[model samples]
Target: MEIKGENISFRYNIDSDWILKDVNIFLKTNQIIGLMGSSGSGKSTLCKILTGYINNYEGDVYLDGEKVNNNGFNPIQLVFQHPEKTINPKWKMNKALNESWNPPKELLDKFGIQQSWLNRWPNELSGGELQRFAVIRALSPKTKFLIADEMTTMLDAVTQVQIWQNVINIAKERKIGVLVVSHDKKLLNRLCDETIHLNIPFKIFFI
Candidate 1:
């Protein structure tokens, strides 16, 4: 399976400056790739576009040569920078985690999520702890591609390393394509197979 973005351009309004323009990417299944750019360079914006979060863009996104549909749970999943924005405030952590599927113990354990935390609400847990649930939710069995947009930014270095290691293991085992979107050059160099830059036109200008 390959996910392709062709000539993607997006703006909040016609009068607003374009955030992304003419971007093209060909991401095949089971590969880990890195996307990096300066702040406000549209890296996160493009991540959202790829996973159907922002569907009003000009370009077409295709999976295995078919146009990507914006229906229910997408085969392409995205974990955002802020966990608080993604989860429901009224739901318990367990309910939020199980919203899509009952995640296995191994997944919870890998992220160091204690069983006790499941009973609490989103506000009770720290940002790092809550983000564990967000990542877990995006890693459901139905997910074919994963976009991690600064997903571990709130975590400490050690926790970041641990989470990334587990993510790589899961991706390799499940044959899931992953897009590691971040400004951290060290992290990108450590995890990604090939690195691409996002700038005006969104072309692969650099390796």
Candidate 2:
């Protein structure tokens, strides 16, 4: 399976400058690709566009040659930098997780989610714990591709390694394509099969 973004362009509004313009990207299920760019280069915006979060973009996002459908459960899932923003404050952690899909106990363990944390509200747990849930939530069986937008930026070094290891393992096992967007070149180098740089000119180069 593959996710392809063709002639993609976007801006905040008519008055604003284009953050992304005529950008094209492609990812295959067997590859773990990294996307890097300077601030304001629209890496996050492109991630949103690819995952159907930003529907007003100028071009098309296709999955296996068909236009992506955003109506129901999205095959392309995104795990954001701030996990707290993604979860509901009123719902318990378990509900937030189960809202996507019920993952197995072993999967939960691999992500370092404690059984007790599931019973607590989003506010009750630390950011790292909440992020663990967020990552797991995006790993539903129905997910065909995952866009990690600075997914581990807030976590400590140890936690970052742990989470990425688990996510990569599961993604490989399920043949899910992964797009990792990050500013840290070293982390990208360590995790990605190939890295694509999104420069100020909106040009993409594979390294």
Candidate 3:
């Protein structure tokens, strides 16, 4: 399966400036693509468009040649840079993690999630711990494509490596396509099969 964004363009409002223009991107089930651009570039906006977050945009997004369905379980799952924003404050970690699928104990063990942390609220666990749960939740069996929008920005170096290790393993096991949006070139080079640079009124090119 593959996700394709063809001629994507966007702006905030009628009078606002355009955030992206004529942007084209594609992700295949067996590939890990890196999206990189300067500050204020529409990398995140494009991710939102691909994952059905922002609807008022130009052009089409197709998942394996079919248009994406906004309603119900989305095959394209997004894990944002901030875990705090990704998770619900009211729900406990256990409830949040198991919302879509019951993750295996081994996955939790690999993420280094303590059994005790599951009972605590999102605010109770540290940032790193909460992010582990968030990433795990995003890796449900139903997820065909996973979008990591700076997903590991908050964790320490060690924690970041640990999380990415688990994510890469899961992606390989499921043959899931991954869109890794990050400003860290080193991290991008380490994981991505190839990289694309997005410019204003964007033109995508290999970097």
Candidate 4:
């Protein structure tokens, strides 16, 4: 399976400058793609467009040659930099996680999520712990493509490596495509099969 964005372009409003323009990208199952850009280059915006979060853009996003349907469970999932923003304050961690899909106990263990932590509110857990849940939640069986938008920027080095390792293992096992958007060139180099740099309005060149 593949997710393809064609002739994509977007701006905040009529008065604003285009953040992304005529940008194209592709990701296939079992492949890891890295997207790099400086600040204000619209890397995150493109991720949102690909995942159907922002639909007002000028071009189209397709999955396996068909236009993506935003209704129902989205095949494309996005994990944001701030996990807390994605979780509901009123819901406990377990409820938040189960909303996507109930992952196996071993899967939870691999992400280092403690059984006790599931009972706590999002506010009670540290960012790293909450991020673990966020990552696991996005790994639902229905998910075909995952766009990680600076997903581990806040974690310590050890924790970041641990989460990425587990995620990569599961992604490979399930033949899921992954788009990792990050500023860390080293991390991208370590994880991605191919890397693309996004220039303003954007020109994408594979390396």
Candidate 5:
């Protein structure tokens, strides 16, 4: 994706507290970079700014060396903490999945999700199942760079590991750029090629 952000800073409101401050970061194409921080340490805020969710920011974000013009959907897509929030409750799995464009039918089998689940509603699925669906939906046909924001936080440990495995496998195979934002040090270490700690100062490492 070749992303770059220069001194990025953001505040919720003018008089309110700033979430991110003077954040400078970049990502090369086809690399998995982890964004790690404590809760409320501006990890989510950084994702938002990167994805153009909260545009009223202090600095510029560039994709492929070009300044990100404020468009609706980012080339850099996000997988939210809760898959249910990203997937529509009113829509069936197929309908929700279709929102991302035409996904290959083979992908469902690859993810170990049955074809029957395609006709089911979001409420009918387990958290892990929903999360898997969300991942496929996000990565299927249109995604370039993914900002996975605590994507497995709601899943069980077993499911979390499985999902991460699938993601890492697919990411490597596709050579997709990934920015995984999480508080789990272990997951970051396992899944990311490089990890960055978004603390008082950003500590980045190639592991």
Candidate 6:
């Protein structure tokens, strides 16, 4: 999905200062746009606003030229950093995969993940396996845009590279827009078509 941000600014509370200020950006269709920042640089906040996770903010987010006031119009899916946090503790992996907008089978194959892993519970899976499953869940049928907020941060270097390659290739092939929030410059440079650095002490630029 194509998206644009116009004069976007956000603050948590009236007493607190603004986190993101006067940001403007336009994302190319089917391109990976990386949001790079330090831990407290509001990269996650920006992701939330873009994905309609946090709607109580300022400015307009447009998808395909229509304003996104809520989650209805923006079909952005997220593959969060911690797989344990996102997946349910009680549910089986198969159940979780089944609940995804698109069944995990197709995406697993696309990502080169073995089909047998689906039967394994979250606890039984390795960190890399869990992360890959989370990504597969996000990229399912209903996903038009993907908001990957530090999605692969916890994985080992090899797994990170593998996941990054899979995501970039699949996203481009499917014409899926990817909004990635990460601190990894190497990964960003490898996977993203455009990169923007956020969370600077005072400066801001959409690159």
Q: What are the per-residue Cα lDDT tens digits for candidate 6 across 1-207?
A: 478887788889989988988777777657888888788878888877877778877778888888765435336787776788878878877788777565546657665567777677788887667877788778765678898988988788887777888888878888888988888888888788888888655525664
Query: lDDT of candidate 4?
Result: 0.89
Query: Please, what are the lDDT tens digits per residue for candidate 2 over residues 64-123?
Result: 998886788988999987888889999988889999689999999888889999899999
Against the correct fold, how does model 1 do in TM-score? 0.95
Query: What is the overall TM-score of model 4 with all chains considered together?
Result: 0.95
Off by over 4 Å in 3: 205-207
lDDT (tens digit, per residue) of candidate 5 on 1-207:
577888887788899876777788887657898888777788888887877777889988888878775465557777878787778789998899878577787777666688899899999999878887888877864567788999888778887887778787877787778998888888888887788777754423321
| Comparison by TM-score, 2 against 5, better one | 2
| 4 Cα displacement, candidate 6 (Å) | 1.2
**Backbone clashes, candidate 1:** 0
Q: Model 5, residue 131: what's the lDDT?
A: 82
Give the worst 10-residue stretch by lDDT in candidate 2. Answer: 198-207
My TM-score estimates for the predictions, one after another, are 0.95, 0.95, 0.95, 0.95, 0.88, 0.86
Off by over 4 Å in 4: 204-207
Candidate 2 residue spans exceeding 4 A from truth: 204-207
State model 1's lDDT: 0.89
List the global CA lDDT of all models.
0.89, 0.88, 0.87, 0.89, 0.79, 0.77
Q: Residue 111 CA error for candidate 2 (Å)?
A: 1.0
In candidate 2, list every pair of residues with a backbone clash.
none
Is candidate 3 or 4 superior in lDDT?
4
